[model samples]
Target chain A: MKQQRDSIPELVWNGNISVEIHQKENSLTYLANLPRHSYFAQILEDLKRLFAPKVALEECWLSSGKASIKWHWPVGVLYDLLSQEDPESATSVPVLWHLVFHVGSFPSSLVVPMGSMETFRTCFFNALKESDYVRNGSSSLVIALSKPETDTYWNSLLNHDFYDYRPIATKLFTSKSRIIPLKIYLGADAPIVQSSASLGYTLGQVLHKQLPRLFPSAVMYSLLKPVLHGIVLPSTVSTDIMNRDFCYPDGFLHIVLIPIST
Target chain B: MASSINAVEDQLSKTLESLQTEEKSSSLQEKIDEIISSYNEKENRKVNLRFKAIGRTPLLRKNVFAINASHRFDKVIRFLKKELGFKPDSSLLLYVNYCFAPAPDEIIGNLYDNFSVDGYLLIYYCVNVAFG
Candidate 1:
């Protein structure tokens, strides 16, 4: 049995290889690199099992227990396609990136979709509960909002009153100004309401524009499980846009902002 | 070709007869006109909406205001700017309920129908990051 198992190649994450795995103790490791192999399609099939509800999840990059958003290449493009706020006119990707986790070490750099940030953070916290760090009860997760360069440029443009006829300047500036920090207690028994802010128009725009581009990592994959099963809104608001069905008749969506500190 | 022309003539005469016989009583015509006018009035109806501030949203001198239902959402935005004396350069964000910032072109009545409560379409307006 050991010989037969040893004959099966261990999965390794070499950017040029497809379908590599390494078994370490009870943990199964998969690599992110693929080289135009047919198994790439098979790997994507396995990934679909982990997506949140209604995510296209057509294709993605998986490595070290982290999953990036679905991307496509058109003809001559070399880089993976990222989700855009404006898909119709979005020729370029946003400064923020998409990455979801299942369970592993936290990456140094990552970005969640605007509307989905709270859910991703909550899921990340839950995933941490299964890790050694939380069992020791010595750590907590922080969500911090930093104004990236793009945000600064947009805010500055609004501050300048660049468009006199339209209130785009003020709307963008006010809504995109700062990040509300959310501190999550690891392994808590109940959901935390760190802070709640009424969502504004510009933030809605940000959500509509950027929400689609989010790709949940493996650590956060639980949020998408209910979604994938066609449960429109899970019982938990901490997962996604709860009460999505009730949004239309009410003509508005009620969002409880989940705070994060990075 | 001649037969086709004859067919055309017959069709024309039928149309003429139909038109001539289509006249209704003057009272009926008046009622129809009234109905049409009422529909137009409904389309152009003025709506009164109540705006509320949540979190650190600035307070308005008068919270209730009447505006044309036919007006686009942008009109309310402009009205807000005027009421608040916000410089054209400053930023403002509006949301229906507490959740979404609607498109500027969305009609007021549509919003009122979907989200209005207690005779008010609860609008949460903010100066954006000012609250943060």
Candidate 2:
């Protein structure tokens, strides 16, 4: 049975446990004061320094089995979480935080190993291509790279640079794990383009929405259908196309976009 | 006493050797052959699909349909569209096991064999707004 979204209290919780990332010039100011000696606080303290001036996660709190992260600008937190050396060995915080974005709800407080983002992206792309939504060779891909608002260099780039220089052209794509604000141009020369923000907030959304727009509406019957399905992803599955280690247990991740009634 | 211990040790060693060689080891080629044959056999089999409407959607009069295992999932989607009188442009989402949406090109046999709950592959279909 489909659990109503509001019924899942853990997902909807607005408790004391919260993370507030205030964007500052050249650095993000984090403002969470977890207990000094606690293990959760230590994890946050270590992660807080990762992005420094480029992207900062300010006051972060983990309490009552719920965590909240707030950031106005796009950052690579999702990429960092999955690309870590040993995700299975990582403590609960990073894994849960990653899950919060993928699935609108968290099935449990325990942070189990979800596979690397690379594997997820590959599996997703393979599935999409197989379904004929995405094609290669003739597909012109424009990966729009934008500096996170927290980066000091962000203000230096003019709007013309955004239009003229492909982020990849500027050599921003040195690493695979870093979030590449992708603008997928479907055809060899299709011109419909959307920025990183307006194309659905998450990476999954961009794949479904913007990518399909590249195709003729009459030719492509289904728009960006989710490469990964369900309201929640499972921890493991023997039958998933990706490596078994990366499979969600079953119903632990949701990729579908449903309209919310206000 | 020493002679008796020696005799028993010799007997145990002989038994162990015989047990070790009782089973013949298959080569890598033989293992590969076996996997290919089993896969081919499974691919040739036919399967039944059971479709059920979810939410406020109208009920399908006849729920069960039979399809070849080798057929692509697109066939099933096309059939549903015709049966439900859905326009070609209208959106329909089909989920296998009521969990994940299988790609249209995915084989029906593979889905039926792996995810079928009660001898029938259950596909839950929902009419959704195409863009949302």
Candidate 3:
């Protein structure tokens, strides 16, 4: 018999998203259920095979409508962040996320060049250091990771192996850290909100402090809903649990806030 | 300019939606206008920034400046590159509190709010020859 209880990380890792990449001329459409916790860069090696056979991977980019996809964000977070654009169809249904693939041209001004493993690696670690700084007042913990250990950590994420990654990552997480690193996106066009929160503060408390008028109550989400890894999180979830289980591989909780429809 | 306006519009809509659920008041429109004005004021707010050089990069001649809150972190990078007189290809990485380099798109207002020290965002930077 299968194990009755799987860890939260495992369950989150197992969550997959139905994706449809629309290539030029619609001749090379790539469709699959991608891992929610994985980065688009992680699967690009295989996904690129379906289209852009002639172009270099480094030249390829993805866009939804007009916004260039930030490759560093967890694919799940991107889905949650983008889902707000069509809130009517976002509930209880597996929506095939449609993305446009562009090769050789990207918004160089807005985002750094991506598609190389090393580029993604650097971006991921840079974000990792940012989180460490918020937690420990410095990134010494992340900087101290040995070369071999760093490679292992990167490989764990690239391979989508959460179990292999957790033990190594546990060092960076501390209950005494200055604040829970959060990239809370209010909307597609809104400026992303990053706020400092004490270790003891619940998710609700943090939201209330960051956007007090909209999130008036610390115990309840009245005007907006917090979606993490595609699940609508109850306001009572503490920072500790969010940090431990729900933090994206880059070491931040990516919360997408959508207005609650009456 | 456009992104900040879009953000303000988004905030207004969300806040207005929330207010609709509140017990109806005679001055609801006034309340909405006040909230919108507050958001606009916030968008126009300025953030204090202090630059400290690490071991690799040289210390800046002038360390402190007031930056518009609506700008993104890349503007700071461009300012540093111009101030330091580094070539386009020269390597420079910036960190907050000497900790980590933020992504280019991170909004200036958010960075100041979360990581600023004594009302200033303590930015540390260095040439990447010593580090990545």
Give the fraction of reference interface contacts each candidate recovers: 0.00, 0.02, 0.47
What tens-digit string does per-residue lDDT give for candidate 1 at A112-170? 22123232223222222212111121111111223353244334222322233123212
**Deviation of model 3 at A40, angstroms:** 1.8
Distance from true location, Cα of B107 in model 3, Å: 1.5
What ranges in model 3 sit over 4 Å off? A1-5, A44-50, A53-58, A85-91, A175-178, B1-41, B56-59
Q: How close is each model in CA RMSD to the real structure?
A: 24.3, 25.1, 5.0
Q: What ordering of candidates by lDDT runs from best to worst?
A: 3, 2, 1
What fraction of the native interface does candidate 3 get right in terms of contacts?
0.47
Candidates' chain A TM-scores: 0.16, 0.19, 0.90
Supply DockQ values for each candidate: 0.01, 0.02, 0.34
Model number with the top TM-score: 3
**What lDDT score is found at residue A164 in candidate 1?**
32
lDDT, model 1, position B70: 62
True contact recovery of candidate 2: 0.02
Full ranking by TM-score: 3, 2, 1
Best by lDDT: 3
How would you encode candidate 3's per-residue C-alpha lDDT over A112-190 as one tens digit per residue? 6665887778778988988887787778888998988888888888777777787777767754575678887866655
Report the number of backbone clashes for model 2: 19
Runs of candidate 2 exceeding 4 Å displacement = A1-262, B1-38, B129-132
The CA-based lDDT of model 3 is what? 0.75
Superposed on the true chain A, the predicted chain A of model 1 yields a TM-score of 0.16
